[model samples]
Target: SDKPNTIETDDSRLDRIEEMITNPNERIRTLENIIINQKPDILNLKIKNRVHERKFWRVSQILGRSSQTMATKVVGSYANDLKNSKIQEKHEVLVKKKRLLEGSMVTTPVPTQKAVTAFYAYMSKSENIPGTHHTLIFDTAITNENNGYHPFSGIFIAPEKGIYVFSFSIRLECHSYGPYELVKNSQVVGVVFSDIRQVCLQDQITGTMVITANKGDDIYVRTHATTSHIGLIPSDDNGRSSFAGWLILN
Candidate 1:
């Protein structure tokens, strides 16, 4: 079994002293002063008439003080400096990222297989076909004005509109003086190269011409000299004109 002990206070002694004093009891004030500890130095008080409130002023004016100084002092303040810097950096980064995204969106992507196939088909359809291996010979013997030898004559017409490539080889046994030329629609397209040893006018002379022609166009190979014999078609050995190969239109 244990008994509780009580602690004594000086409140009775303090009350007795207050009763003897004529002036109002200053004990509560003194006790309050002691508890508060700090004294306001009123003699050293400064009257600050600046736009912002002082630090010692009431907290109610803090918002006003902050507002007043915000334009000038806030930029260098510790918390606001870092916060503003970070905010600006984030804004710049976001702007740069947005610009990069916009740039990427502007570029066109590679075409798909279907798109490429369609483009190729369109190009092929639009392009004209190229002509190949066309030959035309004329009968020169029909005129008979220049010796017994006949000259080559006649125009070969194209059935379809296309690019045409033609070649000719001419051989003469008796007359070396006569001239031969390959023509397209009566226009001279090519001539025999007499200077080249391989293309001399002795046994055979060959020439080539490439032209783009329309449908139903006439092309011919003609000779300057004339003869009674039709020299366009192949004759049996004696200066007879003859035509050969795939010259007939289908």
Candidate 2:
């Protein structure tokens, strides 16, 4: 007789499937545990990113300061180089003049005999600020006996060949310095310097010189090429700048 096959019923099959599948509550619990375990690692990653950002900014700031320092040094060096170049150029000009003198090409002016007792002129005011090598106008003439001194041009045009004595005073305002030279025929013969060291302090500097002058020779005061940007040094009621001259021989 054939053994009766064990009948596979639907209820038995369903019972086996239920055993194989996990419960929904157990799956939810497993997901929760996985998220909880990874939370600290996520927080550590965020913290590390912030630290890296801070370090990058710090390094950038340091580099910025270094670049600024380098730029300052470069600018200062360039300015110094320019100053040296000017000095060298001035030296070259002096050497050339010295060479010309050594060649005996220049002749001395003959001294004039005594003629006029004195051709005297004096001025009290500086009309305007003069530029480099520009004549300073003495607009207000106190006395011009021989009329050799011209207030409009600030020049003493020699009425006749003679030896002349010239004097000048320069007074600058507070916090100012003005250095001017006595010029004869486009040559600097003397210098007068004035400086106000303290604020609100003002003073005057004066110079005197005697020189042989040819007829129609121009004599005046002028500023140096290195004068301040203000150009003309101003004089107020605090002090006065003056110019005076007298012919010693004519």
Instruction: Say which candidate scores most in TM-score.
Output: 2
lDDT of 1 by residue, 114-221 (tens): 211000000101111112223333443232211212133334455555565555555443323334566656566666532222342334465666677666666555
For model 1, the stretches where C-alpha displacement exceeds 4 angstroms are 1-153, 193-202, 225-250
Task: Name the candidate that leads on lDDT.
Answer: 2
**Candidate 2, which segments miss by more than 4 Å at Cα?**
1-130, 197-199, 229-232, 235-238
Candidate 2 local lDDT, residue 77: 97
RMSD of each: 20.3, 27.9
Candidate 2 per-residue C-alpha lDDT over 22-88 given as tens digits, one digit per residue, 9 for 90 to 100:
5766788899999999999999999999999999999989988998998899999999999999999
